[model samples]
Target: MTTPVLEARGLSRAFGHVLALDDADFEVYPGEVTALIGDNGAGKSTLVKALSGNLAVDSGEIKFAGEPIQLTSPTQASALGIETVYQDLALAPHLDPVQNMYLGRELMRGGLGGAVGLMNVNEMRSQSRVAFDELGATVRSLTTPVGSMSGGQRQAVAIARAVHWANKVVFLDEPTAALGVRQTKNVLETIRRVRDKGIAVVFISHSMPHVMEVSDRVQVLRLGHRAAVLDAKHTNMEELVGLMTGASTKGAA
Candidate 1:
């Protein structure tokens, strides 16, 4: 009976004639992985955006750490230690790992150096290296541009960066797309490490096998709302697919 770290009820969002999120309800607990899966246009993306403060909900209630709060902007969410890593990874292709890690929130030097717009490059690099090491990410060279790295390495860097800054919740969108077996294994291991840090990991994916393998609880979305929230251990992929396709209603939340 652990309290959910993040919770939403009656969430709705519309785009002209289309309803992206229709009274969707979702929850994720601290220190556990929650998978959000659905067919195309089933409101998975919409719900992620709503909870991450990238999109406003037309109607609903959101509770963070048992307190109702409004996420008016991405900054507000970040302040609350909420970070989202989209499928794109959002890393700067040209910048190195250290640079990309502190892309927006760069550290400034002290006093005169700070007044002259000098960055604390050494400190940033040190912290970046520590983060990579802590996450068990294999980065041969932190100085190389992320564009040159393999997809899995780049994914590790992106996830490591998010985990370093996020203390409460991190929403990952399709972290293991198009990765080789070894690379995918590394990425999954990194996720377990993040969860062990007492952070809520919301994994959004279309791969049922990956979802079933990594998630503690699977929340299925159909049409525009939550169809079922089933224990991942007890539910099979066939049941998840059935719930997503509206072919079965045996596991309604």
Candidate 2:
């Protein structure tokens, strides 16, 4: 069997006296979408923060590509090919897709010491276009600033940016939260594309239908601890909800 792309064992975190995450065990496999679902204050965000290196874990182990890793910062996670796209969609509204895609990690023609020192705008644009195309995104102009795009378009840009840079896993927080039906479909399709490309995806969402539609497995968290994990094919929304609410015991295989 192929090893998991990202795995967390005995993951725990706390804020002051409040335990935000408790012994959360999660695993994501290449080319698969794993939905992390829970109600408000269920520790989904906390788990994500720890997994993405935005917050330190009190005790736990994270293994990427089957090897133990210490992720101290978001940059460290990115360096290890772990990219996270939060609900806020962190794009500069004033910048175009290409610029936003390459925001901090802009491609330069050469190092500062090199004779040719210049930003590679053309290279960034070309790559951004390729990334969007791969996801079947309908961004007419890579030159159009993100603020001018619709919410779905902005979400697409964020996902595209992650795909362009991430080599291992991607974490998406509430990807379709406020998107219209069509826009949500677009975003979901882009997620499918990401999974098809052999990238492990940890999708966090509250919409049960969306979770059932796109996820291979569903993991439910309640009060900072894992409630259950169920196979999407084998469970229904009611069952999932029940598990999340501590009313049922069945879970994903």
Query: Over the stretch 162-242, how does candidate 2's per-residue lDDT look in tens digits?
Result: 888888899999999989999889988888888888888889999999999999988898878888878899989999888
> Can you give the lDDT of residue 107 in candidate 1?
98
User: Which runs in model 2 stand beyond 4 Å of their true positions?
Assistant: 111-117, 251-253
TM agreement with the true structure for every prediction: 0.97, 0.94
Give lDDT per model, in order.
Answer: 0.90, 0.88
Among these predictions, the greatest lDDT belongs to: 1
Runs of candidate 1 exceeding 4 Å displacement: none
Tens digits of per-residue lDDT, candidate 1, 141-170, equal: 889999999888888888988898899999
What is the alpha-carbon lDDT of model 2 when measured against the actual structure? 0.88
- Superposed by TM-score, candidate 2 places the C-alpha of residue 75 at a distance from the truth, in angstroms, of 1.2
